[model samples]
Target chain A: MSTTTLQRPATPSAVHLTFGRVVASEWRKLFSLRSTWWTLGLAVLLQVGMAAILGAAARAVAASGQGTLPVDGVQAASAGLQFSQLAIVALAVLTITAEYSSGQIRVTLAAVPRRTPVLLAKALVLTGVVLVTAVVSSALSVGALALVAGEHISFALPGAESARILAGAPLYLVGIAVLSLGVGALMRHTAGAIAALMGFLLVIENVFAAIPWKPLQIISPWLPGTAGSRLMSTDADIAAAQAVPHHVGAVLGAWQGYGVLVAWAVLALVAAVLVLRSRDA
Target chain B: MIEAHGLSKVYGTTRAVDDISFTVRPGIVTGFLGPNGAGKSTTMRMIMGLDRPTSGTVTVNGKPYVEHRAPLTQVGALLEAKAVHPGRTARQHLRVVGATHGLGARRVDEVLEMTGLGPVADKRVKGFSLGMGQRLGIAVALLGDPSTLILDEPVNGLDPEGVIWVRDLVRYLAGQGRTVFLSSHLMAEMAQTADHVIVIGRGRILADAPMATLLAGPGQEASRARAPRATELAAVLRSQGLTVTQTGADTLEIVAGTPAVAEAALAAGIAVHELAPVRASLEDAYLALTADEVEYHSGVGAPANPEVAR
Candidate 1:
C-alpha cells in the first residue's frame, strides 16, 4: 500500500460506472478549468449589471415624465441576457470542444466507452450550472431594480406575466447552452464550433433579413436566436426588432418560442449523439 | 485479455490497419512493435473503443470496451500523454477521470505519488515537462487499477531512470498476472522488456512470435562475389530454397547466414570475392523485417534490397 510501490489491487471491487458518477465527473471537469469560472463570472456580472443599468436609465426617463419609453420589468430584469448569451455559449462550446481539442475526448471516451453517457453528462452539468446562474442573475436583477427603481418602471405586465419572464429566461438560456454543446460535439474544434454557433445565432438571421426577397426574410423567426429572444421578451415585435432591426412582428408566441428552442436543442442533440455513436472519438 | 479478429481500419485512400488478428493474453508483457504509422496506435484505439473497426471487431475481457460496465477497471489505456486541458492541474485531471468510475480521491492521490507526480500535482499541466506529462498519463491509466493496461509509447520522453522504472513496473505487473500491452517503435527496449512481440509494418503484421523466436530468426546477410558472376550466384542460391535479393552489381543479400550461402556458392564453383555476416541486432532484424513497409524510407542505402510486402 506504499505510494511508491504502484500495485494494482489484485481484486477490484464490483464497482459499476453509473450515470451519477459520470455527472459528478463532468461537473468536476466543468469547474476545473479557469475559462469556466471566468465565463460564468463575466456572464453573471453582465446579466445583473446591464439589467441594473438599463433599469436605472428607464427609471430616470420615467422621473422626467417626458420621454420615458415604457420598460417592462421582466425585460428590464433580463436586459443583459442578450449580451451574456455569448458567455453561456462559450462555456457550452468549451464543455465539448476543449475535450476534443486537447485530445481529452479519447481519455473520456475510454473511461466511459458507451459515449452517450458522456454527452448526456456534459449537457446535464452545463444545464445545471447555466440554469442556476441565469436564475440567480435574473432574480438579482429584478430584486435590485425593485429596491432602487421599481416605482418608476411602467408595467410590461404585472404579477404572473413578469414571473413568466423570470422563469422563461433561464429555460431559454439552458436551451441555448444545450444547443451550443451539441454544436460543439459536432464541430469538435473550439474556434470552429464557437464560430459556427455564434455566426448562426448572431449573423445568419440578420443576413437572411437583409436579403431583399420577402420569402427569405420570413425564415428568420424560426432561428434559435429569434426563438430564444421571444422567450426573454414580453413583446414579440420588440424582441424580433431587437434581434434584427428591420424584422418586425416575426417572433413566435411565448409557448411557441419555447417549443421551437426546445426543438432546436433536441434536434441538435440527436444529431450529435448519432455522430458520436457511429464515428471515432 | 484482449482479442481482435480481422480488425482493420481504412482512412480515405489509406489502409491504416489491415486485417490484423492477435490476442494479448494476461500474465505477460506483450510488446506491440511497429515502425511509426504501422497501425499500432490504431489497433490500440480500436481495442479501447475510441475507434470503431471498419470491418472487424475487438474485445476486451469478453465484450467490446463500450459494452463493459466498468471499462476503466477492465482496461486502462494511455493513448496519448497530456490529453488534458492546459488550464487544469495534474491532480484535477486525474480526479476528473477517476470520478467517471467512482474512483476515489485516495486512489488518485496514490497514483500521483506512485508516478512521481505528487510534487507537481497541483501545477497546471501546460507547464509540465514531457516526462512529467508521461507520468501523469501513466497515473491516470493506473487510477482504476485495471486488470488490463494498454499503453502507447509509455517510455517516450522519459529519462533513463523513468525508463527503467517503467520497465520494471510493467514486468512486475505481468508477474502479478495482469496484462500489459504496450506499443513502442524502439526494438532495443522491446527486446529487453517484452515476453512476446507482435511486430507490424505498413498496417500488416510482419511477425507475431515470442521475443526469443524473433531474435533468433533468419536475418539478412550480404555475400559478395565477382561482379560478373553475382547474378549467377544469386540464382544458384535461390535454387537452394534461399531467398536471394540483388543488393549491388557484385553483392547479393540472402536471408540466411554466411556459412550456408558461402558453402553453396563454393560448391557451385562460384568464387566469392568476400563473404561476411552482417551482425543482426534487434534493430537490424526489425529493419530487415519491415524493409519494404516503411512509408518514409530514409535516403541512406535504402536497405540495399527491399523485401516484397506480403
Candidate 2:
C-alpha cells in the first residue's frame, strides 16, 4: 500500500490581525469605498477653496485698513475647517453606518467577535485618516491664504499659539469624528444618525445657549461643536472678550480648550460603546 | 467536529431558533435540512458566532468559536448568499479579509483561482450575477482552508452545472477528512450530496441519522404486490400482513419490507402480475418528518387523498 501526504499552505492566526491589523484593514475598507473618497475629496475642496476665497476677501478688507487681520494666518487659513467639519462628521458616521445599511456589519462582527475591538478599530482608523487630512488641509489653506492675500501674515509657525491652533484643528476634527461615530452607533441608521448629529451641533446646543441663563452658557462650552469651534479660533482677544466669567481661563488656555474637546469625545465614545454592546448587529 | 448544545435564539417575542442540538462530524457532508422558516439560517449564524445564542452554546473543534485562536482557520462559513460590499471588486474584497489574518494578496488570488472567479476577479460585486456572487461567497469561505465548512443554502441560485459543481466540491472537501455542514430546503440536493442528515423543523431536531438508515426507517411506508390479475393484487396483498392500496385497476401498492412475500403468494396459487419494491424518496422522508411542524400549512388536501378527489 502506498501513502500520500497532502500539502497545505500556512494559515495565519486570527490574532495576527491584532487591534493594529484590524485598524489597518478598517482603514483600507474606509478608503476603498467610493463614498469615503467622495466625502474626503469634498472636505478638501471646501476647506481649500473657502480658505482661498476668504483669504482674498480678508486681504481686500485689510488693505483698505478698515478691518484688522482678524486672527493669525493659520486660523484664517483654516477658515474652511468650520464648514469642512460637517464633511468629516459625515465620513465618520458613514464609516460604520454603511455596514448597517448594507448588512455587512454581521460579517464584520463574525470576523472579529470581540465587539469592542471592532468599534475601537473603526474609531482609530477614522481618527488617523481624518487627522492627517485635517492637518494637511489646514496647513495648505494657511499657506494659500498668505500667498494670495499678499500680506506678510505675521503667523507664528511652531510658536506656542501657532502650534496650539495647528494641533487643535486636527484634534477638533477628531472629536467631531468620534461624536458622529457615537451618534451613528446609537442610531444605527445613516440618515437618522446624520440628522441627529447635525441637529445637536447646529440647533439644540445653540438653542440651549440662547436661554437667559448663566449655567447654560457655562455648560455650553463643553458641547461637542461649541468646544470644537472654540478650540479652532486663534484670536486670544476675541476669545477672551466672548468668554464667560468662569470660562475665561479654562476656555482661553490652549490645553484647557483641548481638554474640553477630549471630555466631549470620551463621553461620546463611552455612549457609543454602551449602545454597540447592547444592540443587535 | 462541531456540536450544538441546547442552542436557542429569540428576536423580541418570537423564537427564531429553539433549543436544538446536534453534532456534525468529519469525513462526511452533513445536510442541515429544514423548511423555509425552520430556523436553519439562524442556527448556522449562531454556530458561526454572528448571532449570540439566547440559551445554549455551539463549539467548534471542542472550543467555543470565539475562543479559537484562528476562527477562520478552524471553521469557515458562507452564511448568506452574498456578504461582500457592492463597491469593492472581488479581489479587493478578498484581500481586505485576507489582510486581517496577515494573509497576503497571493492567498486571495489563490482562492479566487480555486473558486474559478479569477476571470472576474477585478469586477465590482454590484455587477456580478447571483451565481457569481455565490461563487465569491464560496471563495471567501475557502480563503483560510479551514478544517470545517458551514455553507447555508449554498446552491440557492446556481444553474445545473453549478449545482453539480458545488456538490462535487463539498463531497471532495469531506473526502479529504474535512467536516462539511450545509443547509438546504431542497431534499433532492441533500439526497445527492449528503452522507448524513440533521433534519430540523419548528426550531427542533426531527431526525439525525445516516442517509441509508433514514431511507430504510420504519415510519415510512413501502409497497410491493403481485397477482395473476393485476386488479386483484391489492386484495391478495392486503390478506397478508401488508396494507395494499390501489394505484390503478391493474396496479396495487403494498407496504412491506420486500417483494419476495408477494412473489411467494403469487407462486402458491395466484399468478404473479408484478412484484416490485416501492422505495421512499428523500422528499418523502423529509415531509414525513416535518409534516406536523410546517408553519402556514396550505390547508389543501394531498393529490393522492381519495376524499379530496371525490
Candidate 3:
C-alpha cells in the first residue's frame, strides 16, 4: 500500500463544482451587505415589537371587561408578521435584484457558470436565514408577550397546537422569502419587483375580495398573503375558536393554507429557474 | 489556448458579433482591437460563456468554459470593471468570487496584494474610485491564478502607475506561458504590451497577425522632400499615383519611401536638399485598416467613402 501510494500524484485530478460550496458562497454574499443586516434587523424588531404592543392592547381591553376578546400567546407573539412580512420579503427580493442592478450577476455567473445552481443556492440560503430569524423573532415575541400579559393571555392550548403554530409561523415566513426571491430573479430589478410584490400582496387580493364576485372571492382566498397567514391561522384559529367558536370557520385549514403557499413558492421557483437558465446575465 | 470558430452574437436586428474565428495562443499576450460597438466585448463574453453565441463555438483548452472541471483555473476574465456590489467590501467581494472555485483566503489575499489593493481591500466598493475599482476587478480576475486571462479594457480608468502595473502583470503572466487575451482602444498600450494583435471592425476581423507584422503591413513608409519647387514635385508625385501633400513653402510630404521620392526628384530634375523617411505609427496602420468600418464618422475631412457621402 505504501509503495502504491508513493506512485500516485500528490494532488487530485480535478475539482468539480459543488453545490455545498456554492450555497456557502451564497451565504457569504447574503450576509456581506449592510442592507441585509438593516433589513433583517428591522424584520425581527418589527415582529417582536408589534407583537408586544398588540398583546398590551389586548390585555388592557380584557382588564376593562371590554367587548374585544383577550389575545392568545401565539397571536400576540406573531402580531409583528403583519408589518414584518414587508421587510422580510423586501430583503429576499433585494438579495437577487441587487446583483442584477449592480451588474454583479455577470461576475457571479462567470464564477459559477451552470447558472441554475446559483439561483437554487440563493433561494435555499434566503430560506434558511429567514427561517432562523423568523423563529427567533416569533419565539421572543410570544415568550415576551406571554410573560407580560400573564393573566389576560391564555397558555391553555395543547402542546401540539402550540408547537404547530410556533413552527408554522417561521415556515410561513420562509415561504414568503423564497417566493420573493423567485420574483426578484424573474424581474431582475429591485424597485419594479418590489412594486409588483407589494401590489399583489396588498392590492390585488384585497381588491378582489371587495369585488362582490363569487369567483373572484375564490381567487382571493388563495392569494399568497391570505394563504401564507393561514399557516399560522390553522392552529391560532383553534385557540380563538375555544373562546368564540364563530372564528374557527373563517380560516383555511393549516395544511390547506400551507399547501397554497408552498404551491406558489414552488411554481415561482420553477419559473425563476427556467428564466434564469435561458437568459443572459 | 483559446479557440473561437464562427462565433457570432446577434442582438435583435444588429449582428453585434458576426461570424468570426480566431485563436489566441499561449506564452504571449494577444490584443483584441476594435472600435466602439465592434463586438469585442460580445466576443469576450461568448468565450467566457457569460453570453451564449447565436451560432458556432468557442473553447478554452479544448473544452467549452462551462464544461471544464475547474473553469476558474482555466480562464480568468474581467468583463467589466467593478462588477461587484457597492455595499460589499473589496475583501468580501473577492472572498465570495474566490469561494466559487474553492479558492481560499490565502489566494484572495495574494491577489489583493498583487493588484496593489491591500490598502483599500477592506473598504466598501461604493467608496472606491474608478481606478481603485479597476484594480479590484483585476484582483478578482487573478484569484484562481488561471492559465488564461481575458480582460476587457483592464487599464481603463487606471492612473499612469496603475496602467504600468497592469501592463507588467499581463506581460509577466504571458511570460510564464499563460494565454493573455486583452482588449483596449488605447493603441499605444496595445503597441507596447501585445506580442500579437487581432483587429476587428463592424463584427469582422480586419487583421490577425503578429504585432510587428501588422505594424509592418501597409502605410509604414512616408518621405518628406524639401525642394525649392515643392509644388511642382508634389504635382509630379501625384501624377505617379502617390499621395503628396505640401506641408510648408518648400516641403512636400510623399506617401512613399525616401529612396523612391529621391529618384522621382532626380528624374524630374528637381534638386532635393532634404529627404527624410517618416515612420508609420501603429495608430496610422490601425486607422488605415479600420477607416471604412468606423461606425460614426466625424464628416469634418474628406469623405471616407465618397460614393456613400454623395
Best by DockQ: 1
- Model 2: residues >4 Å from true position, as ranges? A1-16, A62-71, A152-158, A211-218, A235-239, A242-254, A277-279, B224-274, B302-310
Q: On residues A159-258, what C-alpha lDDT tens digit does candidate 3 reach at each position?
A: 7876777787789888888899999999989999999988888788679767876677667768878877776664555456447644322446777878
Q: What is the C-alpha RMSD of each candidate to the true structure, in Å?
A: 7.4, 6.1, 5.2
Compute the lDDT of residue B101 as modeled in candidate 3: 61
Chain A TM-scores, candidates in order: 0.86, 0.85, 0.86
A-chain TM-score in candidate 2?
Answer: 0.85
Writing each residue's lDDT as its tens digit, candidate 3 over B1-310 gives 9999999899999998889999999999999987878899999999988889999999999999987656788888998887899999999999898776667788888998898888888999998998898888888788878899999999898989988998999999999999999999888899999999999988999999999998888764788889999989898888899989899999988889998998888899989989998866667778899898878776678544332211
Tens digits of per-residue lDDT for model 2 on B1-310?
Answer: 8999999999898788889888999999999987877899989888877778999999999998876655668777887756777898988888777666676688888999988899999988889888888888888888878899999989878888889999999999999999999998778889889999998888889899998888777564565554547655555566666676777656666667555455646555666656677788777777778878777576466522111111
DockQ (CA atoms), all models: 0.60, 0.38, 0.55
- Given candidate 2, what's the lDDT at residue B72? 68
Which residue ranges in model 3 land beyond 4 Å of their true spot? A1-16, A234-251, B226-242, B248-251, B264-274, B302-310
lDDT of 1 by residue, B1-310 (tens): 9999999899998999999999999999999988788899999999998888988999889898877777888898888989998999999999999887778879988999888888899999999988898999999888888899999999998999999999998998899999999998767888889999898988899999888888777755544444458999989989999888788888777778788987898799888887776656667677778888888766686552232111
Listed for every candidate in order, the interface RMSD values in angstroms are: 1.3, 2.3, 1.9
Docking quality class, candidate 3:
medium
